[model samples]
Target: MADFRTVPFLPTAFHDDATLDLDGQAALAATVAAAGVDGVNVLGLTTGEVTSLRVEEIGDVVAATRRGAAGLPVGVGLGPPGAGTLALARAAAAAGADLLVAPVPAGSDPLAPLGEVAELGLPLWLHHHPAVTGARRSGDELAALATEIGAAVVVVEEAPPGDLLAVLAGGASAGVGGLAALFLPEEVEAGAVGTVAGCAVPERLVEVVARYRAEDAGAAWDAYLELLPWLRLEVGSPGLRVRKEAWRQRGVLSSGRVREGAPLAAASKLAITRRLRQVGADVSAPYPGS
Candidate 1:
């Protein structure tokens, strides 16, 4: 059972050629760990780009993440029980993942497909995203389902990610992505354990969580507020290049290229520069065309 506090929803790092950058992947995990994350998750939100990965590639990514995790727990997102779900789960576990994020089908029994994944012997993170799945479970329902399936945590995707309703329902809860940052205070007040956001620099978020949990909510708000500009730069269709670019500029990644090939907007590029400068981040100068 992994109890996370500031888990980062990591992106798959890639080289300029769009191949998996194992070193970059490791560095991303290391960077997040340095920020003091309780755990780190990749591939849960990765379904958007899931079609781009082969089974072996997924395994490789998990192994690379494990290498850089500094002994912290790691989690991977798994989809509905496809013929390959078990294989993917085994790969993730063999590669060092301690848990699986299982997305429940919408408007149906959330536990319908979980038995197979639980069989992998890794704890499960039940993901309930009504917006994506079209079946919204109330807080009580989420809490009940988690209890029924013995979920280590219930990941709710909703505004505030804290999801007051779910928290009030009485289960351990976590939220994901940029939206979690938007109303962290509300999320915290609502009793969210921590958030799962994927970003190049996670120290800022770690600080916010630490500050908030320590009861200096005003300081937490200040830390989270400073990240508003950077967090909002979800550029490109399905959006992630800006973050990859941030990693590149910081020397953590070689390039910001993603599988989708959507060019980073010119304005986003400028915004990344401004925000990085504001944080006094040391960006690597002079990429090939810049």
Candidate 2:
């Protein structure tokens, strides 16, 4: 479980016209994975903007994600077992995905989707997020699902503390999300094996985790603090564009276009330059998005 490091969902990069940038996706993966994340989510309905992509485009994302992750474990998020969902699972499996992140489907049997995709034979990850689905599961329920799917990792987001304890007590390897995960040091101290974070700049996430483990709490807090300005951009809304802009600032992505989400204000993009500079990232290089 200690080996489970911080895993950020790779934000989908796009052309200004909103078409997927396959090369940018790969570059995002390779750069962040190299920065020290143990794993990455390359096919999230939110982070990857899968909701706005064509079914065939998802396969492209799977391939690009695989290329970027190299040999590291790759996680793919699936909603439910439908024709579209199954297609995604097949693509992710073919791409050699090591983990499947799932949420309990609404208006259907909670675990039925996992059972339907059981043939995929991938390790499961329970992403307990109620914000997206408006339904939350107990830790016991999550543990049972993990047992059913033979899951190796569990993620708790927007859930109660006791539920997390329940899952941990069930002998599940638990990862932290929500605000707790925002501060890696606190989450690590509270028994999180890993984190579910955005992949705008993984080196900062890595630094915080490394410092905390090295018993340098001050440095860890300082590192986490420096990232606060950027992270705050996503507080009240989906800041996918903001994150992409940061990647642009880091010289990794070409554009920060979103399919349907809120566009990042130009003022915020300028502020990102200062944020990137605080982390010592060379922001001089310009990307097309910049």
- Pick the lDDT winner: 1
* CA lDDT of each prediction against the hidden true structure: 0.70, 0.69
Give the lowest summed-lDDT range of ten residues in model 1: 169-178
TM-score of 2: 0.87
Residue-wise lDDT of candidate 1 within 184-216, one digit each (tens)? 566666666666667666787777777776778
Q: Against the true structure, candidate 1 has what lDDT?
A: 0.70
Please list all clashing residue pairs in model 2, or write none if there are none.
Answer: none
lDDT (Cα, tens digit) per residue for candidate 2, span 1-290: 33537788887778888888889989988998899887888656456676677767777787788888877888888753345777777776776777778765554466666676666778777676667766566667767777777666676665344446444642755555543245555455556667777746678778877877677778878888886766666444556676778787777877778888677766777667766666677675543354
> Candidate 1: lDDT of 205?
74
Candidate with maximal TM-score? 1
Q: Please estimate how well model 2 matches the true structure, expressed as its whole-model Cα lDDT.
A: 0.69
Clash pairs detected, candidate 1: none
lDDT of 2 at 19: 86
